[model samples]
Target chain A: MSEVVSALAGARASGMVELADAGATGMITLRGDHALLGAAVQAVLGLAMPEVRRVVAGEGAQVLWMSPDELLVITGYDVAPGLAADLQSALGDAFATVAVVSDARALIRLSGAQARDVLAKLCPVDFADFPVGALRRTRAAQVAAAVWRTSDSDWSLICFRSVAGYVWEALVTVAQPGGEVALYR
Target chain B: MLLLTCPCCGVTAEETEFANGGEAHLKRFGPGSDDADYEAYMFARKNPRGVHFERWRHIYGCGKWFLMARCTMTLEVFGTYRAQTSEPPAEIVAKIKARRPEWEGF
Candidate 1:
């Protein structure tokens, strides 16, 4: 097993203001004909359309519903390349179009006591009912993102590459060590 | 929360996702048309205090606009249908009659 990276090192390398990126986590985006995406995603990852809005995550994998038809899926950093190819093959040309966006996003994981509270202050969506295992496709701070709760106290927020640096800076600055903010790698 | 049923997207979504576009089935008088008729068309309206038929757009969902009749006092929703369609659904008519007994069978 690989040794866990130090929180301070993870934060500095990730440059996140809220929470640090484990730096090795893989982020991918799947966009296709909205009608076909649900089944395609289901076939690729054994997950279905996340129906709980911002409060629940899909069972097998951390799936966040980005829109009525769009979704975001997160997994271990090392699994990305193979999964991207598998996803592309599953939904060939029959589905209008299929695009595997493996490198278009920045994946940041925020865990700790103050994670939810800090997210609430940064994003507009109501967090009171946002339960673990749910995915939310909404604006994080002011940027478009797909947020998925991996556990009771941890969440994965994915955003576009352009604003990735900004988001990282914001989370790291607010994330404290002992109480409100904690870094997980 | 107010619920809107879109013809394309079906029955789902909160009122915040939609925009109210005013009364449904109301016709407008052209400038070249008769004067009194224009006056009646422009100024006169159903203005019903009970259930009112209105147009609403599902801005955040399927993006299709629809017409629905809902109670103003009770806020009870009747039914919804496509905006450009010729007539309201029979279910909507039935709901209107059921809610407003005076308009029964009309």
Candidate 2:
């Protein structure tokens, strides 16, 4: 078996905000009717379906509303590979596209008081009014990213694995020690 | 600088966040369709100065395709609806009619 290595081997940095790899997280992109998702989500994560643009985080799992007909399920890396079978069984004979896309993406965490500023600089989202648990899927610099608040001072961001190195550096660069925007504070 | 709302996810974001996918409500022609119908579907597009209908993908947000009714001149948006809808809903059509009385019917 190939050793599952994260895009960045647990890269960590602290500047305007704290940046760190979210390990080799597991992600599932579900595109189908909510009737099937509700059952699968309930069975897999024991959480209710999230509303549009909202993220439901529980324990070590999170269910994010990616669109009207799409949901992104995030869980621990090891638990992700086997989750497809479990989700398919829960979906029964219903039609849906369930894909285990953990390896296709990279997760990074930004914490500290200036974390929001770090995200705001790269992404065009209204961070001033952004509340916790609200998911914002927008462009981060030149790449697409899904962002959510884990706490008042902490944020989580997921982008394509191919751009992990660039995204990591971008996050770190935007969050330079003296580059604090101080807008969200 | 346009802040278009997405009916699917209900997120009103900048124009950069969404992608403009040309004209909306196009009746796709198939193999059995006449040449004229195919030509209209392929090349004919509405470029009205007053009211315009367009297809936009909320590429950065919900990743859903939706239709928008807006004024091509003023850049004022009338409304947005799901892409599954074949035509503009009654309320939106009425709104455009009331605002721009000379607009041709969709």
Query: How well does candidate 1 score on lDDT at residue B30?
Result: 90
Cα lDDT of model 2 by residue, A1-185, tens digit: 89999898899998987899988889888889987897789987799999778899888889998877888989988988688778877887788988999899999999998888899899988898888999989999988899999799989999999999999999989998989778887
- Of candidate 2 chain B, the 10-residue stretch with the lowest lDDT total is B44-53
The CA-based lDDT of model 1 is what?
A: 0.63
Model 1 TM? 0.54
Tens digits of per-residue lDDT for model 1, A3-110: 633223355422222466655455456655555776777788877665635432344345555544455566665676677678777777655343445456777778
Give per-model TM-scores. Answer: 0.54, 0.94
Residue-wise lDDT of candidate 1 within B4-106, one digit each (tens)? 6666456354576577888788777898989988998888877777878889986544446788888887777887877876567788788787768786332
Checking candidate 2 for backbone clashes, the offending pairs are: none
Q: Which run of 10 residues does model 1 chain B get worst, by summed lDDT? A: B5-14
| Candidate 1 Cα errors over 4 Å, as ranges | A1-18, A32-39, A52-61, A76-78, A173-185, B1-106
Each candidate: what lDDT?
0.63, 0.88
Task: Quote the TM-score that chain A achieves in each candidate.
Answer: 0.70, 0.96
Candidate 2 local Cα displacement, residue A50, angstroms: 1.4
